[model samples]
Target: MTTTSEHTQSVATATPSRMLRYLPASALLIDAALMTLVGLVAIVGRRELDVFASSAQVEDQLVLAGPLMIVGWIATVALLGGYRRDVFGVGTDEYRRVLNASLLAAGVTGVVCYLARFDLSRGFFLLAYGLGVPSLILGRMALRRALHSARRRGLLRHRVLIAGSRAHIDEIARVLGREPWLGYEVIGALTPEYDLSEETATGVPVVGNADEATSLAKAYNADSIFFAGGAVGSSSQFRRAIWELEHESIQVVIAPSVTDISNERINIRPVGGLPLMHIEPPTWSDASRWGKRLFDLAGSLFLVLVFSPLFAFAALSVKLHDRGPVLFRQERIGKDGGRFACLKFRTMVVDAEARLNSLHEASGHSEGLFKMKDDPRITVPGRWLRRFSIDELPQLFNVVRGDMSLVGPRPPLLREVESYDVDTTRRLHVRPGMTGLWQVSGRSDLTWDEAIRLDLYYVDNWSMLQDISILTKTLGAVVSSRGAY
Candidate 1:
């Protein structure tokens, strides 16, 4: 087996390219340019072709306000941590920051104009605010997609060295490895002396013990050092390790023991100069819950209207192909273990369930789940419908009926729910979804454990932004049909 040093050297040779290093700066510059362009356009549009003929005082005010607005917007984003490296390619935090910064910039500009008695055109101000914020958000999204593409190809990622007990390091490595878009490439691990092997359970090489973590991290040229739960024996020791790494300009991250918690629910308080992390209980606030319900109702209604033609086509095709029912409705476990009939376009032969046992040996799915790459029970039209996820279109009605949401954990069949362990049953905490994180991530191809993990993560971290992101990706996943049966 290769020694830990050799493994570290091999990984260090694969460091991300110089172009990757400048991504944040490039994004910042592009945002600045976009803001300036939007501001100039707003000014010119408001003044029309007579911009130059405007009073000298007005022109001077416009010039001064334009630069100040641009500078202030950029500064606000910076202060809000929009340009942080960790926020570059994953989640909605970056977009939220950009929005916050834009609003702050607009509010400050309005206050300044009021104090100075400069009559800034309301039309111009509104136009600039409206256009610039969306443009900046879109630009960031575009950059994030580019970065994700690079990460998938192993081109842009931080070389991460994990420090912790064997079990924690293994868990961390497994989770990080599954999310390439998060852009952490684990180079190796540092564990306590009890571990003999030079490799983690997940096969991330063990480079050193915690005592030698700083040196090993440097040797590996790691971009970040992640301390898994109980990596050091004490908080003071962990602080010392962080201090040592900071002197070397290395980034340090500590993974809390908790899983599936959203950052929005976490607060850090400093007491007696010691930082304490407090986790707020998950919000089941009526307003938030009802807000989601309202969104689901509206979205489902809109989709049902828009896809009425496709739904008719599917129904006609299913009926003509096999003279079977046009829709498939099966009892599924919903929120709080309530039984509801989940709807789908019929995508199987009339006796699909009766034939299920016969095909079990060839199905290749684990217990409590059923999937087959080329299930013979699927009719020709049904296969086509499944490939494009058209069969799921009828779930919109379920959404409208309040039995499901546009996004949430997958609705589990009654049998599947019966087999769910205590931990897995947490999936029933929220209404099932028409499409969700699992649908976008891998759909039918994911292993039971992987699917359950994703479902639990979604359950704990549900947000409007996350739901939108999943829905947007679901279209791509359907088109690709990589994991569809």
Candidate 2:
């Protein structure tokens, strides 16, 4: 019988990596095409000439410019990682790369013009750079939408196999479930510890053991196999599996055991015989505290100025719907065990807090946490306000008053603060937020454990960049209304 190692070796070598096959080539071609069209327009527009101009001299100049533009496009894209598989059709990373590539191209053209003693019109380069960056970004945006739509219809997807302990494999499944646009359809998982029966784990079926992992992956025609943590017994086993998979044309992804390692801080060095991953723990200092405070102050001030009209509108809406108070100010825990009144629009009735005790037994949310999804106290206008998160607009005042921030952990109610275990209190290490990791992540859908973990992650990794990213995502999440109640 053919050994599992032999079977896998056949697959990996035989199947070319999809990175080279799909996204890169397509991206390069689209970019080159875009550059070519832009170059033609720039040449004609700068010369103040028309297509098929009566003058042969204009046509000759255009012809010469075309090849130079093509060369510049190729050189720029290569230098800027425009064809990297990892960046294709996802996130702002792709657009950022495109902009970097265009800028690099301009630099190359600038240097070449100086060296060659050609009096190239500066207007041509300026026009191309100005138009090309936005054009390329727009093109990628359109293509990304098309690709995402295709993924939803079940096309352009990869079949993947995961190898790990049951828990880690399940974690991978949950992650993949959230990113349908990534186009990973997990085929199954392989575990050495248990038979992991044929039944599906997290919607992915368990295929077989480690010894038979390669064969099973091939049998399913898997495009990629992920070796999750705690699955492979030894380095030899991993090497043997990689060698075997080489013949079967399957790619491999080794999941690291480390958690809480940000992409910014993790570096990999292939030493002697091992790929050693070097992770530097986040360095925190007093400077970070002052910087964060400054950011919070400036951001809060800007938001207050921009949203002043919205605040007036919200106050008017609340007053017209229910002749109750416009603002709801409740005492909540803040940084260093401080007390502050968190502000929000009065979405519930004036007597909502008084009625809470009577309806305690029927409360649909966490008992220690105060959440009432379908509370009878909510007015008709409150539902619309809550759905779009307009009700939380008053928290800008809290931010202005130094009681809250644009991004941070949520401030628990006085009763909820009292219910906290020692570990849960870590959330209070920073000032509370108008919208937090919990709010943008899953809000009411998050379990208490998940909520705490995310909060801690934010505290440990707090940076102005992270805060801005979270705040931007918060706007999108609020608009999409995912997991919002």
Candidate 3:
């Protein structure tokens, strides 16, 4: 055990660990390489360039100027915090920043070249920036994917020490446990001073009590410290804990009780020198539903036009396979207990519905949402259609006809709706969607409870932006066919 005094000393003298020490260098090099490549492409695409000062040769001028441009672009991105660990982690902010920085770099280059009378080719400059910014964004996305993969494998993780009530601490732990790619490796936890549990209910070991938090964090070399509910007795204790750990190279995060809320709904307001967090109520109203309906009308029509060929192909394939109707319309529970005929390409035998109960008994599926990995009723064309979600193409008609939205909860069957308890019925508040959070996040692989939670969340916190994002992700999900059976 590290003594309190030793921990105090270490806290005062702690420095950044070797973990991810080369990240900044790596980012710098990546940006430079992308910029250099774009510059060379611009030169070859537009060989006619103005002479630099007394240098009449375009190649000679570029040989000196290209590296300088690359260095400037990298410097601008660094200045704008594009390479920050937190910013680059979980959102589009990283890509946005890289784009902003690149555009700013382009503007600065143009301004400087004009002011200094450096005769630069307009075509070359335009080509360089037009290609460079998007290329840079793509590079960052690739880097982020690689980083996320590394994090999933337990590499480049932040060693975290949690402090809070056992309930809150374990809740936080469980969330981290689910999202391994977030790179938070829980080392141990600190509970309230009144309790003396060996570990949290979630099995996260208790290293110390709340009062020992600062010392324990230092002792463990924790790169990140989380303070949840019951972590500190009062505001003063929390302040003191913060003050003591201020010298250490550690990130202090307060995550006692927020979950499943989008960042768009959260804001901070300072009153009387105290920062109070405000959470907006969820969006759920008839007016909002209409707005979403309009969106669905437009989106579904666009999709139908674009994928009309696929529609014809799938219909013919399914019809040829079984000589059954190409379109399979099943009555699904829609908004507020309304019934709608949900459409799909016929992907199952004519007797698929009649066999549901027998299949359920055979599979021992006691869940509300029935799923089987290999159902015997699926026809040959149906199997291929389900793989890439081609079976769902006809739902575009559902969206256009107002029977569903472009994005909302998956239309449930009457039997499924009948099994809903009070809370589960909340999913009916919004129109059923052709694809939704349920589609992008695991699809058929999701548990009944998980699917319910996602649908309820979508119904409660409906937003146009969220719908658009889900639609974008749906394409990728369909292509990857993850969790699709």
Q: If scored against the real structure, what TM-score would every candidate get?
A: 0.87, 0.82, 0.89
Q: Is candidate 2 or candidate 3 better by TM-score?
A: 3
For candidate 3, write residues 1-485 as lDDT tens digits: 86544543554455434567667677777888888888888877766543233334446667767777888888889888987867755877888888889989999999988998887777677889999998888888788788789898878888888899999998899889878888888878888878888777877777788888777877777889999988888899889988988988788999949877777778989999888999998775642456777877887889899999988898889889878888888899988899988888989999888999898888888757677888899899988899999998888888788888888888988988888899889888878888899999999988888888898888777788888899899999999999877
Residue-by-residue lDDT tens digits, candidate 1, 190-279: 888777777876778887888677888777778888898758888888878877877885778888677678788789999998879999
| Candidate order, lDDT descending | 1, 3, 2
Per-residue lDDT of candidate 2, residues 1-485 (tens digit)? 75445544554444323443576777777777887788767766767734333433434544676577677776777677777666765667788877887778778778877898665666566767777788888888877888788777767777777888777888877767666877887756788755545534564556678667788876767788888876788999888888887877677888765665466667899999788998766533321376777887888889878989988898898998878889898888888788988888888888998988778866555545666567698888788889889888778778777887778887888878887888777678788887777888888778777787788777766677778888888998899887766
| Most TM-score-accurate candidate | 3
Q: In model 2, state the lDDT of residue 121.
A: 66
Model 2 residue 117 CA deviation in Å: 2.5
The global Cα lDDT (0 to 1) of model 3 is 0.82
Model 2, clash count? 17
Stretch of 10 with least lDDT, candidate 1: 49-58
Candidate 1: clashing residue pairs, number: 0
Give the runs in model 1 whose Cα sits over 4 Å from its true position: 1-5, 12-20, 47-69, 91-93, 108-122, 283-295, 400-402
Give the candidate order by descending TM-score.
3, 1, 2
CA-only RMSD, every prediction: 3.3, 5.7, 4.6
**Model 1 misses residue 246 by how many Å?**
2.6
The TM-score, computed over Cα atoms with residue i paired to residue i, of candidate 2 is: 0.82
